[model samples]
Target: EQVKVSKQNFLLGRGERLTDDIVIKGGGGPKEPPYTFGEARRRLSPMVSETSSRIDELPQAACPGDEAVISLTINPEYVAKSFFPHELMRDVGIEVIGSRPKKTVPEKRSRGREPSEVFTTELFARGRRAAIRNWSQQLPDWRSDRGSANALISIEEISAPVPHAKIKGSLPEQGRMALETVLHASELEFSMIQAFAAYLESQGIEADLGHSFFAKGLCFLELDAPVERADDIALFTGVRTLRQMPSLRILRPTVRSADIPTTDLELPTEGPVSEDVRVAIFDGGVPENHALTQWTSRLELPGMLPATEGFLSHGVGVTSAALFGHIDTKVPLPRPYANIDHYRVLDEAPGQDPHKLYEILGRIEGVLSSQEYDFINLSLGPCLPIEDDDVHAWTAVLDDRLSRVSTLAMIAVGNGGEGDSILGLDRVQVPSDCVNALAIGACDTPGKDWQRAPYSSKGPGRSPGLVKPDLVDFGGEFSRPFVVVAPDATPSLTTTGGTSFAAPSVLRLGTGIRAHFGSNLNHLAIRTLLVHTCEEGDQDHKENHKEIGWGRVARSLDDIILCDDDTVRVVYQGEISPAKYIRAAIPVPADPMSGMVTIKATICYKTQTDPHHPGNYTQAGLEVTFRPNDSKYSRNNQVHPNSASFFGSSLPGATEDELRRDAWKWENCLHAVQRKRGSSLINPCFDIHYNARLEGRNFAPPESLSYAMVVSIHAKGVADLYDQVVRQYATQIEPLRPVLEMPIRT
Candidate 1:
């Protein structure tokens, strides 16, 4: 077999250190010798110039025939020659052939068909370490056949294909002895002395002191290097460290949504009844006088530095916009409602602490359990490595623990620009990384680049593949303050951009949808609506976009005012299973007994699958809704259901006050269910299940359901029958009931 020489196989240098080498044009392996030097000279004469009289100094063996292996390396200039073909000397007796990749190389040369590139580089937060002890040892014949001399190739540089800095030096006698001592004592492999010697040289320092070998890439129990050079070492060869990238320019606010200022649309000015719903803002604290609230209070983080400081005003700004942006001010914006119960977690002193955060999460749990909050928005995160199980596991624990109790725990994906924190196995931040947690990434409209904000973190997920951010919203500066605060306070609003800002806007929008629609609004359903009804763009083009996980979200404040309906429409496909349930909820206004009301519901859906792989299946559906007559009961049943209870529920009559008391029980139960708990009270029982058979197994296709319930009330005897008709038409629904039941099995 002819050894094929290819340009791609040729590498400039191995590892981090720069070095050079030359190659032998053609040669056969050991065990064969040419008849005489003169005979070899004659065979090589045509390939050499007359000045190359010393060519015969090296001997060549004859080809061993077509069945035998032949080894050779092409001249470096062979690249210049573009794989120039050459005729072999027939007398050599070897069958010269094109070279194949190592994987495709004949089995005999492989000794035992071992895999190539079977090496791992241990990545740290900053750098990576690779061990060459298990690397294949190059045989003497291998070098001679390749036309390389007797120098041993350093495995550190050439072992793996990745590029990095390398250090090389001779270890001190004492250092080498100490290294040997430590290695022997610790039952380690490789020459620790040599490794340390090289490391010192790479760091531009001298190590006269001895060191010991430790396991897992830690070669030193102690070192002789100077301590002052620590910064330099960390900057260069130390663990993976990173510098913040250059900051981006703040872009101007530009709205492109069809819902923005489209054909003067007037909403029911006095239609919405203040529910006094409390929602927590898990970001920077709220600012006093913020347009959302004329009245505000502060919460303290136990270990915070400044005692009274909040993370920042960013979170408060978001909440203010969401719950009460509709306040009257000299600089009047869209201040809709003033009802809000806010919790500030991020901007507290000494920065946000996860431990403290667990407490905050507990607080959210309490609020949710007490039925005091309509939702909670988390606009903050941590700057830690999250690509491993420990971090992800921790985040999972939080999500599992918190999500069950909170009405909505919205987390931000962080404003860490693309590729910023990707170093050292670092993944997206925690909380957002947690499963069941809704992570939100930011989007800028008429976005300067007409693209998603450059800073928004993206994900399919780093570790367990959590469906992060659930949805996106216009989180840019333009929607800030307005989307962030409730509609009662007055505060200075400024430019704020982040998934943090977007999160609140979506949260508020969700609340509004739920308020006018109903509390049964399933977030997944809203996410689907955003994906389907939001402004659409080139789908094929977004395949590579990381930030715009789905695409630009489409929101319609206008549509919400005009639309009058609610529902869960399931279009079944394939065999449905009983294992997975399709759960949905919508907001329902209080039912009014004094007047007539109207309610309309519908469900629309379709079966979909990958065009290329139809065997893989999924389902999608939609439901339009309308309610003209919603009864406002004096005693509203606002009971909070456990996570599982919410997933699949059976109802009983209870006033809103009673419901608040059960909220925590509901959340705790839900959390337990997520943890796979079993018990009659907490176990998931009622649900519309679907099975999406995957591979040879059937499973549930992803399911989503949304709900909205609206109710209008009127005083009795205040109007004529015809006038009463108009009033009743405005709000007419009494304890609305529209349900869907489906069974799917895997």
Candidate 2:
């Protein structure tokens, strides 16, 4: 009884950092060219002439002085390092916009010839287009030293505008159609789009401008056009893609609620505990009569005029879950940790308005730009599954917005898990693929035998974000439905289920952590802590990685903040400089002991995204190397200690070669655990290298990155391991404490 009480009293690190970054020096050698001069020319010449001829036919209405956009696909061998076609593109009067990774098949199945990146560049005015047409003579010599084959050899193909890559999603058979034009992010290009709209109007094709926004370096124009012109609009020059806009619907689980049972429960009337922490919920509007208005400030969006009863119930259920998790049938309910700002962004008539997707996104963006928040929850997004080649407007804009702020945002991965697997409709939805935020899925229950809910989305997300639903939490099941406050005036409760409620449930856990400790932990630290302490299934099933990534998050604050009998966990929250190496020592006992020891580390960082580059989306990545003992050195090296497999080796996919080359660098979050004999542990630490890129290539003069890492050590035979680690590291580290005391729920 005494030992249990002592362990619960001490919390983990509250941002009282204990270490500084130590720099390291490393070197590498050069590589020989893969493609010869003749082989490269054979592939690139036809593409240039085809693009030049297409540019001549393009209407000068959208481009500035008839300048157009073209794309070049690079071989995979080049994208793994710093080999680009900079000189070749510049000499041809072209300026690059950005690049995205795409699948390719070379003529010969060479060893390193795999799927690679595509660069989007601009061809200058009329004269430059003519210059490119006289290709054999006008283009530089690939054999000459001045016009080296090193860069141009990287090109696999050049893309033209009318390639049938546009026309996305399933289009409605009749009525006004909403088609979005994905144009280049250029001022002159937008003017061309305006003139093109007028030209369409003159041709008797209606093009109602809905909305537009800049994502990274691309422009998205939403227009309500006539259905008859869909085929003609797809062939427009310089327009990258044309697609049907997706609609937003209330997220409901697979199990119908008509047969689900409900029960009444009691609740507390006390207000939120924290004054510093601010949170927001973007969903359908709540009803005027509800029990949570005291801790929640409900506000309608600018154009919200009416509401639906079903939609209102969904909004109330999600908001209620954010305040109080599943109501215990046997235990009393707990009070909210902080107040909420719930913005009603959608209503019943969304189906009638083809432009509702853009309108709702605008309202959400408007609020984010105006107000600063510590936490935000989004239980809704476009009802469309994510794709491999291109990113949707909703995902691009929302990710760009979240990267600029210091807020922890949580989004629900759509309820498409029951869809047809052959068509990939079961994959995670758009905006949930935002690498900057947590895409949450739902578990069927909160007990030890929990499994992924049949309605929760599944994923092998795009490359940089392979592990899709970052974490899972208990939603409702047919037998044990989740409980929420009823829409009536009293504090009565009802049962329901969906990933929508699962999302806010995770947010509630995060807010509770902040409410208990105040400003001691930042958003990045909290994110890392959640990943570190998540409980995975006892069995090792590789396929489960897609179903519930990093397993389910800790259920209660006591489970996260309290110490175990033989284990100790600490957090490091700080910033790392670009293109540099910093080392963090894993805190262990001063002297070695008997029995086996276990070590686990988790690192999470916020990254700037390149929405156009889905495969290479995250701009920043950390390569972590674990060195167990300072005394152990490799036979071939004399300077630094040897590195053992720690982070990348445990992940399901990837060959040994790909893991070391660049695959590990693109992962924004990593977690792994290893157990070793205690005698083998002398002094352990991790070497972290920060790598930054732009458009799938090296980015010079990069900015610093915010990151958080948690490392825990557990000794098999040491019952007092936590106390020993705290005392031995007294010179550098200490336990975290709460800034204020409240009647916290156990």
Candidate 3:
């Protein structure tokens, strides 16, 4: 359906005629790509047996005598039957373990189409000699003619037998295994740890539990056992042997402390603060007597020890940056844009218990559920880098919580990016991999000559390479650090540099947007605005692209949302139902003398996550298309000839297919077409279509899945397009006014 465009008279004094035949193509063309029997059979071959005779011809290794953990690939068509895999496993005496959508390399044919996807679930079963063999024998009979009562495609072992000699090298010398285990949230009360402990005791083994975490369907356990008993635990609790094996083990993490340099710069004792926007800072404890304490409400969660001098620096620095704008001792300190609510969750004592770090997840959940805040800043994150195959509990929990709650969480991408080490590059620390969080990396000040801070992390990010550090901000550069108030009564200041400081800078911007927009703006809208305003300078510097995603975000909210005389900016915030599209029409300048018009659009949305499936973590994605009013591109046309040329010109000679693959179909955020004339032989309007899809999932998305889109049109070297559009579509376009600051009360 067409979005209503308000009608208003435009005073077109210039001798330029308006195009009368403006048309909008209604719906997207059929999305399904034609499938062939040969292709389907080839794709299904790895998982499906043709007949009972074929099952008998399987390799001998497929029928192991003892129990094993195996991965079963199921057809996408059969996934809707919720009871299919469970019942089949029960019938076969196999236990269903953790499951994730199988990651398939996108084929050329898969481009521009939402292809049907498949899933692979890890399963544990014993008596494979009997159960699997029997099932294979009866497969032909169960599928008489054309019945699929059984959804089992193919099963392959996931666990490999470790040689007894090599097992010693794999286990710790002290018999301690710092594991990061995952337990189903629903089964937390079942106490799998106790069960495993009992099993170990029966085998004459002794162990000690180090650290454990339980929150919202996730459990992380750390165990210390005798070195000799490691094999038994590995064999018994293996995903192949039992379903209770840890999802991942914390093997030799490269943890480094943030290098905080101290300075004698003194901070102002008082500054202006606004209560209109409330921000929660989750980091090391903020000292109550600190100079910024007057503007901050500090609370220490249960089990948090009193802040020590060393621990106070990181949290205080982060909190100060968040409350007050980036600290520049060269100028008068800027007043805080929002009231602060700080939650202390980190303790950095030497040789502190590792368990405390793991437990921070629960305390964070407590604060998020119990407290109310518009924005949450997590300047503290584990130094461990995330794996492509696994999603850490910290990342999963934050993504789940933030998407459900109204609050937006900004996370630091860690300070591990220093040094010439290969591990330091493109490695975003845990939780920073969180797709929902606004992960920020550090860049040097004066973003125009923007350089990623030597210590700022980079990313191809978690699996499938979703962009991390969604954007960058001026944190501080080498030799020159951001200065902030120290946690001392003397009003002393300190210098620090890291993504930790970078995150709060975004927080400052967020609070400003919230304060200006009031309650009308949502997190997705705020995120859209931030990313939409990001200025990626000098596209020729391709090396810096990944290090500084999208480039540094514009510091001023007014600069992002408000338009100059030649440009008209329109923001759309609403929800789109699953598998549906929403269309908005843009009124082109009526003055044919409008010269060259550039249209840039950005779309951002938050999706419910399936952490187990990091490969397809975002369950929902928005597909957007901008169709200019040109007769050359008809409603039924598959390719827009003008679109190809426009993209080729704007994207530096990119092919039509490459442009379609990168900007239009692949990414969730689409920004394209910067310089096309308004008076070119075409229709007088452009249509923006948003289509939301439930990617790689069997079910539909929830009813209220929100999304925000920002579309701005600029008339280069011509009349004021903003006034013209405002005069023409007064009801449809509402200009965002700059926030007027009230007099500060000291």
Q: Which candidate is the best by TM-score?
A: 2
Cα lDDT of model 1 by residue, 86-106, tens digit = 222121222222121111111
Q: Which whole-number lDDT from 0 to 100 does residue 550 have in model 1?
A: 41
Give per-residue CA lDDT, model 2, range 444-506, as digits (tens). 998888889998989867667777888899888887788778776766777888888888999
What residue runs in model 3 are displaced by over 4 Å at the alpha carbon?
Answer: 1-69, 73-133, 140-144, 149-173, 183-194, 209-218, 227-231, 236-273, 348-351, 419-426, 463-465, 591-594, 634-674, 680-695, 742-746
Which candidate model has the greater TM-score, 1 or 3?
Answer: 3
Q: For each candidate, what TM-score against the reference?
A: 0.40, 0.93, 0.76
Candidate 2: stretches off by over 4 Å: 1-4, 14-20, 62-64, 109-128, 140-142, 170-175, 186-189, 198-204, 258-264, 652-661, 742-746
lDDT of 3 by residue, 463-541 (tens): 3335676788877664566766766666666566667777888888888777756666677778877877788766776
Candidate 1, residue 279: the lDDT equals 54
Q: What is the RMSD, in Å, between candidate 3 and the native fold over all Cα? A: 8.6
For candidate 2, which ten residues in a row score worst on lDDT?
Answer: 118-127
Is candidate 1 or 3 superior in lDDT? 3
Error of 1 at 495 (Å): 2.3
The TM-score, computed over Cα atoms with residue i paired to residue i, of candidate 2 is 0.93
Model 1, total clashes: 129
